[model samples]
Target: MTGAAAGTASRPLLGSAVAALALAALTALVASGSDLVSAFDARFRAGADRAFGASAGSWLGPDGPADAVGSALLGAGLLTALGVLLYRRRPGAALWVLVGLTVQFAAETALETLVGRPMPLPADGSAPDPGYSFPSGHAASATLILMVLLAVLRTGTRVWWSCLALGSALVAAVGVSRVLADAHHAADVAGGVLLGLVVGCAVAWRVGVRSPHLSGKETR
Candidate 1:
């Protein structure tokens, strides 16, 4: 490969490695109950709870809007993107999307199980959310889905920027909602975003490198 090609190839691998390492470090910190992490989590959760309250309704809470974006919205977006790719005869890109999603899901699940961090208690004294909480699954899912859509539909500079802005807003909203609902720590959200980044970069690399036809370049 030429120097430019080599650099392009290494970029995704490097990004994934860095993100993975950061996630591992964060997981260790959470797993070990680091005092710093605990203090930050406590402070942030307290502030969020005060600002939004426990009864902030489903729209601003973790279970309704955020969950919808991560699950139903993501599902719809993924299916649509896959359809576009297949319609354009880019089966390789579609395959990479599936592969990347599978990897992201597995990684998120493994971290959640391995860390086994408990969810924050609701401000209203309700029972805490069930299951491990080292990483916010909603945050990860939203990030991955939005990123995949961005990669698949970036047909022009204007479209790419628009998609990026929208995707970022959605991801941030999901992460913040989790904190507001006391469903996860801020660290958990950060870890989930990093995990998504790791897998998303791999998918982008495969789609851009192996399936140049689907790179979505603008025609003159």
Candidate 2:
């Protein structure tokens, strides 16, 4: 293999390694129960709770808006349909997106199981603190979905650019919403985004290197 080919081949492995390291660091940070992290999380929850007021906050609360968005993304079966379409049209690209999302899901589950970070409580004791809070699964899912969509639909048109911008904004909103709902700490969302991006880029790069025809690039 040429030097360029060798480098291209190695990118996925490198990206996966970096993603694993990020997960490990996040797990340790949550497990250690760092005083600084606790203080920051407390302050964030307090600020959000104060800003949104009780009623409005409850509507946009953890199990309300966040769960609704996540469910719509998964429960409504959009992702599955899209995956099927891509699988029929571009199997390489479909596999890349699937692999990336799978990696994110596995990493998030492991961290949630091992770290068991507790979420901050609301003032009125209304919001439920149900599961581990190390990495925001919603944020990770949103990020992965958006990135995969962008990769598969790379049309290079005005519409394509617009879609990319809108998708990125949507992903950011989901991540921020997790914090606003006090469902996760700022760091948890951040770590999830990092992991998603790493895995997404890794898979995309690998797919591009292996099969350019499937990368949504126009061939004339």
Clashing residue pairs in candidate 1 (N, C-alpha, C atoms within 3 angstroms): none
RMSD of 2: 4.2
Worst 10 residues of 1 by lDDT: 211-220
lDDT of 1 by residue, 103-123 (tens): 888988898888889887665
Q: Least accurate stretch of 10 residues (summed lDDT) in model 2?
A: 211-220
How well does candidate 1 score on lDDT at residue 57? 58
Off by over 4 Å in 1: 46-73, 76-80, 83-89, 149-156, 213-220
Candidate 2 displacement at residue 131 in angstroms: 2.2
lDDT of 2: 0.65
Each candidate: RMSD to true structure? Answer: 3.4, 4.2
Error of 1 at 38 (Å): 2.5
Candidate 2 on 42-134: residue-level lDDT in tens? 676566557655524556665567546644544333365366436547666666666777888898888788887777464446765878787
